[model samples]
Target: MKFLEKKVKSMEPIFAKGGKLEKLHYVYDGLATFLFTPATTTKRGAHIRDGVDLKRTMFIVVMALVPALLFGMYNTGHWHMVAESGNMDLPYLNDFGAKLLYGLIKVLPMVVVSYAVGLGVEFIFCTIKGHPIHEGFLVSGMLIPLVMPVEVPLWMVAVATIFAVVIGKEVFGGTGMNILNVALTARAFLFFAYPTSMSGDKVWMGGQEADGFSGATFLGDAASLVSDSPTVDGATGLMDKFSAMDSFIGIIPGSIGETSVIACLIGAVILIATGVGSLRVMLSFALGGLGMGYLFNLIGPGLGNEYMQIPAYMHLLVGGFAFGAIFMATDPVTAAQTATGKIWYGVFGGMLAVMIRVLNPAYPEGVMLAILFMNVMAPLIDHYVVQVNINRRLKRLKTA
Candidate 1:
């Protein structure tokens, strides 16, 4: 037995001290590193180290977003079935299998295209730059499909993904360097490039062409009402014109994954529980949107006969507000890092989204633009936060 133990020990591969294996082990350690190492490092002063790498952080964000993806899949199928049968009366189709399969068929292509094109670009960039491939797109790719209307052309999706990856991400030197969220950039590109395809009510309901569709999203109806009011040949009140409850429950027309607020809330809970996202940001964003929406509702109705306002609740459930707040705005890499900074980011993003949604009659959804805007400002917010910390530290030292 002693001889056998000695042989086994001898056969073990010798590893150099603090060498490649050690570094590899550390690199792959995941969340354990964050707990063990200090977040800051100082050469001569207060040096701290942390094991948490960007990969681990990004992974957490992905985990939190899974619930949303799953729910979005189901909702996509549900809307398609509803549109196919011309049954706007029903909340959800009874046929689960068909609904699910249809949704998978419609959404999977976009998801695959986004991952394929985006990741391909990322890999090429990583190879050229001589750096490890960053997995930021793992979340962004999934997000792309979620924010898009179900009926968006597959070719458009592919083109938009390439555009976002090349222009929005790669041009800025790859992940962690881009100023805006890649997924939002793709959606924005599609929205501007193909306004008719992206915005109308018929777009969200798949198989619209076969069904002789005349669908109108909440925001689309609002815009139509505003644009073609009493002066136009035929016009109606936006609220009287559309089903508010349908919009609230996501039975109405809109983007594929963004229509369902219940699903979004469920996803938000999962994200919060996993510690993958900031509750502060989410809450603040919701509050900001609700506050603005209420203010708009109160003020718009009082403005005049033609300029009517949408309900407050409609703003929260309609378009991409919930989806963006729960997923896009909370992106740690492109969002404010500090707790205080998160509040400002969320509020600002929500306010901007609502402002554009209500104020600008041309574009309907503003969540994508709002998120992209905040992403650009995140670094500035973090810088100011860090400066505040520095000032506090200096004051403490002086007192000491």
Candidate 2:
């Protein structure tokens, strides 16, 4: 390791200013920083210091996402095989290896495309600005693929990544300066620009082209039930089709990584345990969803409002609620920075997610929109929080 570090240092001069390969300094620095902890330190300053840098922090997030990512792959392959076999009850591709291989075939290409385009844009910007590349996109790149429909076109993925990196991050001064989560920005672009491809049951399942069981998401089913029947029986029947355990275990159809509550919980544990994520945001966001869902339940299923029948627990487990709360909303860059503000930010986002999902049947998934909306409001929430603290401190000084 010492020799490798020395070798990297030796080559650094070649990539330094005025060197022949100086143009690629960003690339060189990125690789070097990834392999070795930076040696330079503040000699004399009042700056707060920490052992963990941005690279290490981002790496932890990516590590936390692994459980969800792996499970998503298996789920993707499972859906594809389920589609191929045309049997929801019978297990398709009975072997785990086979399921994993199939998922890899479908999911890997999207991951590659996301990273390639996002990083390519970042490199271009860094080279033009003479700035080092920001490590923020490392998590966004993985997230873009996870939240997308399995059957979306590769070109669309590329376009979304370009939009997300350039408009979502770079336009706002990049990384921590961005107002919204970059990955969710890409998804928002897709959801709005290509609504047909991004939403609905047909797109959620991987191998829909090959017949098989084609059905709406749980939210989708509830939406349709409201349109079709207003009776309590219809509401009960709709809920019966979906088991809470299956939703928790993530056997249902949805986005690549969001279907499995168990997987998201595992990722959440990793994020919180490492202190990379916020428990305040996670818990508050969940509470908001539960509060909204329960409120809707009190309304009851009647007059074509079947979404009310879905239990609060179901709302938390299904769709991107858990995933977005744990991963997206907890993003240190885009989320509310003030400790108190984070609570407000999360609660509002969670409640709004359920509200949008229930009230606006046109958009079955609301986590994406809710988080993006809250991202824009995060600054305002923080401002109010800071002002309250300021007033309190001023009053104390007067008393003193």
Candidate 3:
């Protein structure tokens, strides 16, 4: 390690002002700092310094996401097997190792493509703009794959990554300057531009066809409940198919990384423990979702539909709701910054997500839209929160 450090230090001058690689100094510097903390320090005005830099924070997030990524890989293999054979024959598919290998085969490419294309764009931008590469994409690159369907094309992933980097991020001045989460932006771009690849029963699983399997996700089946077209493919009602326990364990077919409530919780624990994630946002976001789901349950029976009658807790268990609440909603760059504002940001994000899922049968997943909407509204939420604090303090001063 010391030898490698010396090697990096020795090469720094070559990328400096008048060296042969002067034009690419920022690129080299970015990579070097990522490998080793920047040796440069503030020599100017007073500044609060901490070792918990951007690279460390993003690394922590990627680490937190590991459980989901692992489980998603296994789940992808599980579902792909089901789709290929057109049956839920667990006994024949009990080879856990095979499932994981198959899943790894399917999921790893998406991850590689995501990072290769996203970081590639970031590198290009850093060179063109003559600025050091931002650490934000390290997390976004992982996130883009997690939110995507297992079968989304590699070319599509590349295009989406480029779109996210150029439109969703770079256009807004990159990283912290962006209004929406870059990952969700890529997913949204694909959702709108290539609905076939992003949605429908065929998108969730691998292979050319879903064979005899229904291939629809929990969210899709749940959404169908409102249309009075409930499916009983497994000889069980919608409620039975998505039994709370199954959803909690995340065996159901869904996006690459959003099936397991347990996995998301694992990530939540890691993020919260590290202090990288805001507990206020996560809690309020969940409470808000539960509140909305409970409301729907009360009124759903009157409408005579099972979808509306799903228990409030179920909303947290299925779809991307848990994943989004745990990972996406807590994004520091896009979420509310104030101590109190985080709560409101999370609550609204949660409520809106459930509302979109239940009310809009056409769109099964609502977390993406919900978080993006809240990202736009975060500043407004903070402004009111700040104003209230100011007014209350003024009232105390007047009383004195």
Candidate 4:
């Protein structure tokens, strides 16, 4: 390890100013710094230093996401196998090693494709603009595949990666400057451009279409029951068959990572403990969803819509609500900057997510749209919060 570090240091001059390879300084610096601690430091400034640089910070987030990634892989494999064999109760599919292998085969290619295309575009931009490569894509690359359906074509994934990198991140001046989550941007692009592949029942669980296999996710089932007079007992009965425990454990069919509330919760704990994620956003987002879910429950039995009667607690368990709240909605760059603004941002996003999920049958899962919508509103939310503080200070000065 020390030998590699020394070798990188020895080549520094070649990539430094007036050196033979100075044209690719950004590339060299990125590689060298990524492997070793950067030699450069502030000579004079009021900077409060921390050991956690951008790379380390992003690395921690990636670590936090590992639980979801692992669980998603197993679930992906289990679903595909079940779909292929047409037997939901197959006990052999329960083996951890077999499930892991199954998931790895299906998911690895998507991950590789995402990183290759995304980083390729990122490298091109950085090399052209003479800017240091940002570590933002490290998280985005992993997230793109995690949030997508397993059956989405590799070509589609590549195209979405390009669109996300170029339009989502780079167009807004790259990385920290973007208004939307780059990963979700790829998903949104895919969702809008290829609705047939992105949504619907058949596209979710990867399998070579077999007899009597249904891929409809819990959210999809709930949406279909909207017109029926669904009672609490009826909703519970229906959900029980789907195995609520599996949803919590993330053994159900859905997006690779969104099915498991438990895995997302584990991620939330890591994010909060590490102080890398906003507790304010997460809490308020969950609260907002619960609030909306309860309101729906109140008005639901009166209405014939079974979707409305779904318990408020179930809202946290199903679809992308938990995953989005923990990861996507808490994105520091795109979320509200102010402490108070984060609260409102989360609250509004949460409410909107549930409202969309229940009211609009066209969109069964509302987390992506909700988070993106709030991303645009985050700046506005922070502005108001800052203005309110300024007004309070002004009033205090006037009274004094």
TM-score for each model = 0.78, 0.93, 0.94, 0.94
Clash pairs, candidate 2, are none
Error of 1 at 216 (Å): 1.6
Q: Name the weakest run of 10 consecutive residues (lDDT summed) in model 3.
A: 41-50
Reference-based lDDT, residue 41, model 3: 48
RMSD of 1: 7.2
lDDT (C-alpha) at residue 301 in model 3: 58
Give the poorly placed runs of model 3, Cα more than 4 Å off: 41-49, 89-93, 208-210, 223-236
**TM-score (C-alpha, index-matched) for candidate 3:** 0.94
Q: Pairing residues by index, what is the TM-score of model 1? A: 0.78
lDDT by residue (1-400, candidate 4, tens digit) is 9998888889989988999988788878877877887776423211113656777777888998999999899888777777888787866346778878988998999999999999888878888999888778989999999999999999999999999999998998887889999999999999999999888777777864775667788888875543455565558645764666777777677899888898899999999998898899999999999999999988787667667877888888888999999999988899998889999999999999999888888888899999999999999999999999999999999999
Q: RMSD, each candidate, Å?
A: 7.2, 2.7, 3.1, 2.5
Ranking the candidates on lDDT from highest down gives 3, 4, 2, 1
RMSD of 4: 2.5
In candidate 3, what are the lDDT values of residues 314-338, reduced to their tens digit? 8899899999999999988889988
Instruction: Give me the displacement of residue 389 in model 1, in angstroms.
Output: 5.6
